[model samples]
Target: MTDQRAPLIQRGIVDLMIAADRLRFQIEAALRPMGINLTQMSLLNHFSWQPDRAQSITELTDVMAINQPGVTKAIAALADRGLVEKIDDAEDARVKRVKITPAGLEALGQARQAAWPPVEAAFGSLDDEELAAFTSHLVKMKASLAIS
Candidate 1:
């Protein structure tokens, strides 16, 4: 018997990849004029989730899809911009963690506002309910990929 599932799986994977690239391009275009790279914005979101706790590079590596070098470079850029600060780990002096500065929070807020106009215009075709459902599936896909 033919493996009918093969075409479905292959097409789904290919479509997802294409969709991801398209969405990333759109987001980058939106974020660019704000003077923030998409990498920096991603780091800011990760850091802001636990503002009090410093997030270690190792922890970020464990959970993030981005490679360590990319994370380091992005963090360095943020540091250079005064948007993030490095904190020494209490247990290990050599290890460092990152926290978003107050300025970083302000930048993040500004960036959020900056990203909206393009996103609103681009996604105008999708109603709120469709957008919500699309987001739900994306979350599920992300979680599934994380385990893989």
Candidate 2:
């Protein structure tokens, strides 16, 4: 039974991975004209979802699942582009928090607009019911992995 299930399990995982990679490529292509890459747009999206549009380097590292140096580098790049600013934490002077500027939000909104068409295209074949079921299954898988 285990041997029989192995192929099914492997195929399922591979299909998901390939789908994700293709979607990522499409999104990246969509974002290219806006002078933003996937990782930068992802960071901007994360900040937009935050209450204060701000987070510490450590927090960003944890959420992005990247190393400290990488987070710092991305933050610096955003800062240089005037999309985000690093501020001294109110309570902890030693900790610097990165906050999105108004321009950052504007860019994020534009990025979303640019990104939506490809995403919609990807799902356009699915009817409403099918889309909902697909999304529900994805949510369940995310939950199973304890991902938010």
Candidate 3:
């Protein structure tokens, strides 16, 4: 006999993907007016958290889960826009570390304001207990995947 649990497992995975996609779309739409996508916003958010800590491209690759070229390109674009800056590492002049500029912090604040409504609306229907459970599940899954 076929495994009865297979369909249940597949449906759960599919439902998670669908929900993630819908949330992403809503966030993207909300951020479009600011001329940034989730990935860029994520980069800004990372930098904003520790404005003084300059992180290398390799570090950013791990955090953003994107390839080096993409990170480099995004950094270049943000640098061009005066949102981020790349400076030579103190110990390693060959390596460049990126940090958020004051403008980036300002943009990040604006982006958060723009993005918060959609995120709040998406979870507004969930009661506190339900939301906490959902978050715990997501955290467990992320840990299982070794995502930082």
| Candidate that would win on lDDT | 3
lDDT of 2 by residue, 1-148 (tens): 4798899989999998998899999999999998887788888888888637578999998888778998888788888999899988999999999988889999999999999998998899999999999999999997788625
User: Deviation in angstroms for 119 in model 1?
Assistant: 2.6
Instruction: Assess the local accuracy of residue 34 in candidate 3 as a C-alpha lDDT between 0 and 100.
Output: 86
lDDT at 49 for candidate 2?
80
For model 1, the superposed segments whose C-alpha errors exceed 4 Å read 1-3
lDDT of 3 by residue, 29-91 (tens): 999998888888889999998998899999999988889999998888889889999999999
- List ranges where model 2 is wrong by over 4 Å: 1-4, 51-53
- Model 1, residue 1: C-alpha shift (Å): 12
lDDT of all predictions? 0.83, 0.88, 0.91
Every model: Cα RMSD to truth:
2.3, 2.2, 2.1
The TM-score obtained by model 3 is: 0.90
| Worst lDDT 10-window in candidate 1 | 114-123
